[model samples]
Target: MTHQTLPTGSVSPEQAAREQSLVDEVVASFAGAESPRLRELMEALARHVHAFVRETRLTEEEWAAAIEFLTAVGHITDDKRQEFILLSDALGLSMQTITVNNEAVGAATEATVFGPFFVEGAPRIELGGDLAFGAKGQPCWVEGTVTDTEGRPLPGARIEVWEADEDGFYDVQYGDGRTAARAHLFTDDNGAYRFWAVTPTPYPIPHDGPVGQMLQAVGRSPMRASHLHFMVSAEGQRTLVTHIFVAGDDYLTHDSVFGVRDSLVRDFALQPAGTPTPDGRDLGDTEWTRTRFDIVLAPAQTASTS
Candidate 1:
């Protein structure tokens, strides 16, 4: 298509009409998509994107800069480090997408953004076992139960837990094959589960990439709230991906990824150096923290279709 170049400043009626027609042209191009849902999505996406460009009166230089930023995000992504996911998180797109997919169903646990660091095949631990696996941080005793929305216990539910250590670094961030600070365990017949993990601390989302630079440019802090990641799944139940945030984390209100939910926050009670542990494991003179996160899952029919 071709068009006459309009002068800068207010858009005349002719220019606005041309812009709308351009959007219509793009939307029409997707009319023949094989999948009805695909056609709808592409057409809607085209209209919204074109509207944004027209509304912002985006300059050529700005478009070029956006392209460059996305290219950098792609260039830095790999099997382990997902810069694009980071970018989405920083922009709140990840959380928005999660919200759109996971609707609240009764008393079910709310879902949150799935960060880029999750790895498959995390080492399995038995109930009441330790997940630290030598990662450095204050020991935390985490216990919880898995139940359906109706409060019925769901036995043998798989719970995957992962978190950053004292230094705010996930095992994957270390770039070594060694895994720590992450593990999976199954609930007992009563739906009760317990394990030891590092006490979570507030940390920044990984900076030093395009996402980080974008955050800095927008005057936004990359800090995330202190929390432990949990992915719970049971047969015939909708899998829940969420975080249990420490009650008093300073970054709770300003989590860079917008992953916090008031319902998910819980107190991490601190025990004295000589306090007795629930599992009878001796911590010697070291203080420990403990928190519980009883999870309620929706039925499989409530799972996200997207």
Candidate 2:
């Protein structure tokens, strides 16, 4: 550990050349970490990030700016606002992490980022019921079935759905005591479920924060395409967290959170008035949109390994 001491506040050629070795020394120091996995991750992260810094010749000013940016992100975070998740989505790291954890084992639903807007305690609904109560949006009919990867029906599955109203506001966003757009329902014995909901509409990620400022600085849009969040689960099956996007949304290709997938997109078929209602909720001449998004889940055994 003994080494030649450079003069105070002075840099010599040999000392400058040894800067890279300091990174290696820090990486080796992580070997004594209590958790083997943690140690491994720290070592790998140190190596990769140190290489990035050296390769890019990152300046002190750039490092200071990064620290400031992350500090600002932290300052804006709260129970209702998840600035860290925003950061992950902005950099595409959230979707990339989801893609790594979820493999295409079969026709099962694809996983995506669990966006920050989801809230618990949504009211429960029957198989054929309306999810949007007092919500301001055009009526839409949504129905689907739950099945295993082999296509066997899974009855009694819990299907949780939530989305923004036509005004592009989630129930949690409104200060009023109203539960507009969110509910949970169970699949019937036939593995079929249906519910009336509002049409998904394009909305911006919660901006007005550091993340939003960064997006604007980079000339990027903050809009997420129209989509409904679904989290389905059944006994003996893996929980599936996903979203079904509107077929022709403008921001489909450029979702700010990068949660869109081709398989998850479905045509929101427009139904003209007088079409026989499935559950008979009695809507007068109002046209409605309909979509069927059957969900398939992998077995728990496979899910755990994945």
Which one wins on lDDT?
1
Full-model lDDT, candidate 1: 0.90
Model 1 alpha-carbon drift over 4 Å, by segment: 1-9
TM-scores, each model vs. reference: 0.94, 0.91
Clashes of 1: 0
lDDT of 1 by residue, 201-237 (tens): 9998889999899889889999999999999999999
**Per-model C-alpha lDDT, please?**
0.90, 0.86
Q: What is the lDDT of residue 263 in candidate 2?
A: 93
**RMSD list, candidates in order:** 3.2, 4.7
The regions of model 2 sitting more than 4 angstroms off are: 1-19, 304-306
Q: Looking at model 1, which ten-residue stretch has the lowest summed lDDT?
A: 1-10
Q: After superposition, how far is residue 269 of candidate 2 from its true place, in Å?
A: 0.9
